[model samples]
Target chain A: MAAISLRRARTIIRKTLEKGQEMGLKPLSVIVLDEGGHVIAFERSDGASPGRFAIAQGKAYGAVMLGMAGTAQMQRAEAQAYFIAAAGAALGGQMVPVPGGILVRDAKGRVLGAVGVTGDTSDNDAAAGRAGIEALGLVAEV
Target chain B: MAAISLRRARTIIRKTLEKGQEMGLKPLSVIVLDEGGHVIAFERSDGASPGRFAIAQGKAYGAVMLGMAGTAQMQRAEAQAYFIAAAGAALGGQMVPVPGGILVRDAKGRVLGAVGVTGDTSDNDAAAGRAGIEALGLVAEV
Candidate 1:
């Protein structure tokens, strides 16, 4: 249960955004959350939407808070804005739903932390984030 | 010059929220912008609508871009969407039409940064944002 390091977060962002570039996606914003789902770092690429950072942070926070991938949480949150709203209120307004993030885990499946990205389609964003994490030879449990 | 760091952005957020408390305003989302009007730090206080962060940032960015407060920009933009939209497009959508933000200047009237706040009515939000900048001993040149 080690705390997520800034180095890991930076690695995740650089790797994931590198993938995004390969895919010809727009600029991206990446947010890294510690095991407790607190933001450790956030970076917005030039030309990313103003919503990029907030959405990215939200996805990462949700991935950790729900102990699942952000895609699942997005489905649930879309159908139940009230629930998500309640969750955000419950979590000090740290939870957001937009897409492009996932939870990282070790071989033993201990939650390492979460990385969220935004600036393209939600699906693409999530894939890029996952690819970023995978590039580091880490697995995304969610 | 170095772009504003996340640490300085955090300072803007913390100090703005503190000013909000002193003003008896609701929880606010605060934004700080660099000379180029990029978002430096962003935070939404407990209970602030998720929309507030975007709005606040836009307000601050818009203030810097228009060389006036957001309230003034809104009116000007109503008359000229192209002016607003062109600038916003150039900025990748960081400018918003809402109010409740101001530019911060040093005692000698040098532009330092911009702060935008939102949580209550746009007017109230701008007032709160103004209070935050004022508390920092910074004045608005416009």
Candidate 2:
């Protein structure tokens, strides 16, 4: 398992936010973490709502923590409020398994960190997040 | 006024986490907010208990929203837990005014944003945040 460098994750977020702006989406928040689910960087755009970064961070961490994209994870959890609350609590409210996450992979397809975004509609949020990953010249296979 | 770009904010977080790991501190939760009190990015390290992001973001937002640092905002708002909680809730749990945020600034003494860290003693969180800002060629002026 090759460790993802902090520099790489940082570059992904920087370029993604820049790309998101070019796409004309609402300013979004992006979070990247190493394979171990630790935060690498979190970025929100100016004029974005406050604390939006937390949602992005939580979604990224949740994806990495669960070894799946947040979109799928939410499906697995379904409408079980108790389960959802428990999951959120287990992650200290950062396990936001929403629709805006994509797992980053190395050339060998090894799972690296995950990138999550929030602040736009679910589709747009996912688009921004996916765009962030793709802009880094990496494939999410999302 | 120059905004805190996602590129720069992510750099600070990654650098700070790397430094904290070297120091053997607990995995920390870091929060960054633009000068307008909007989140730019954040991270919650693995093994970092949940809930830190909320507190950290709240502190960062409160700092900028109040036109003061987290500590000073807490000093003024300490007498009003209800008010603080209400504010935090009103902002969807993103308003934290704890003791871990610093006013991010450029060399010209212009304010850019605020960075806050958690998952340790408040003082330690503040120190880690400061370390990241300094690493980014900027100052975390209190």
lDDT tens digits, residues A1-142, model 2?
3655545666677676666777877877777777777666666676677767667777787787778787787776786657766877887777887788778887778888888877777667777667667765677733
Candidate 2 error regions (>4 Å)? A77-85, B1-31, B34-38, B42-101, B104-113, B116-141
For this target, which candidate reaches the highest TM-score against the unseen true structure?
2
Docking class of 2: acceptable
| Highest lDDT against the true fold, candidate | 2
Model 2: DockQ score: 0.33
Q: State the lDDT at B83 in candidate 1.
A: 84
- How high is the CA lDDT of each candidate model? 0.72, 0.74
Model 1: per-residue Cα lDDT over B8-83, one tens digit each: 5555566767777887888777777767676655565644544665677677877787677776777878998788
